[model samples]
Target: MVVDGTYAKMWISKGILYFVYKEIYEINRIMAKQIVSQRLQLQNENSYPIFCDLRAVKNAQKQARDYLAIEGAYMTTALALLVEDEHSMVITQLYIKTSNPTYPTRVFTNKEKALLFLQDYKE
Candidate 1:
């Protein structure tokens, strides 16, 4: 389900994503995000930011590209830094902190903090 608040995003169903790089994995993840984004398109949209969670299924990291590649989401870049710590650094965090945002896009660790930041953020 897409949790609505300050942080609008789709929650990846537990085990919905498969760790295998099989073709189905990508398709499934994409389909799931597509459904959620459509549901939570934008409403009373806040400048708070956008956050995506990749809590499990290591292969899902690249799904961010597919999810954000959408039209409105282009301005939406995500930092999956907090969602997972897969031996790699969170490049998206640096992107958000150092760069300027043309759109309402920002990603955080867990949904709670992200929601809080987006909900309470003052423009």
Candidate 2:
């Protein structure tokens, strides 16, 4: 199943949930909640490894990051963040360092590597 939200597009394939952020959007707390809610709906109570493509995201507020790290982890087995540019990389790194997610989470510059990482956690 696939779902498109204000900040990103989400889909599930195999046992992985994919979230691809829209180009140049600033994510706030409310947006984070909405995104996670949508993801929960898509998953339908089944947990899955998540692959998030954040290459296009411009900015993410600290509240949003915190909410995602805590609340957004529902129905998620693990998380793989795909980043291309330095900006996205920094954001991903910051999220890891500051939020300290309970689930296994990693950042990758290569999509294939990210997928391979998430595959291990797929249900």
Best by lDDT: 2
Per-model TM-score on C-alpha atoms? 0.39, 0.92
**Which pairs of residues collide in candidate 1?**
50-106
Local error of candidate 1 at 65, Å? 0.9
**TM-score of decoy 2:** 0.92
Candidate 1 lDDT tens digits, 1-123: 433332224432321211111122333455546544543444223222344454543343345544544443442323222344523226555544555444444554555655554443233
The alpha-carbon lDDT assigned to residue 92 of candidate 2 equals 76
Cand. 1 Cα-lDDT: 0.39
Clashes of 1: 1
Best by TM-score: 2
Which regions of candidate 2 are displaced past 4 Å? none
Candidate 1 Cα misplacement greater than 4 A, ranges: 1-33, 40-51, 60-82, 86-91, 94-101, 104-107, 110-112, 121-123
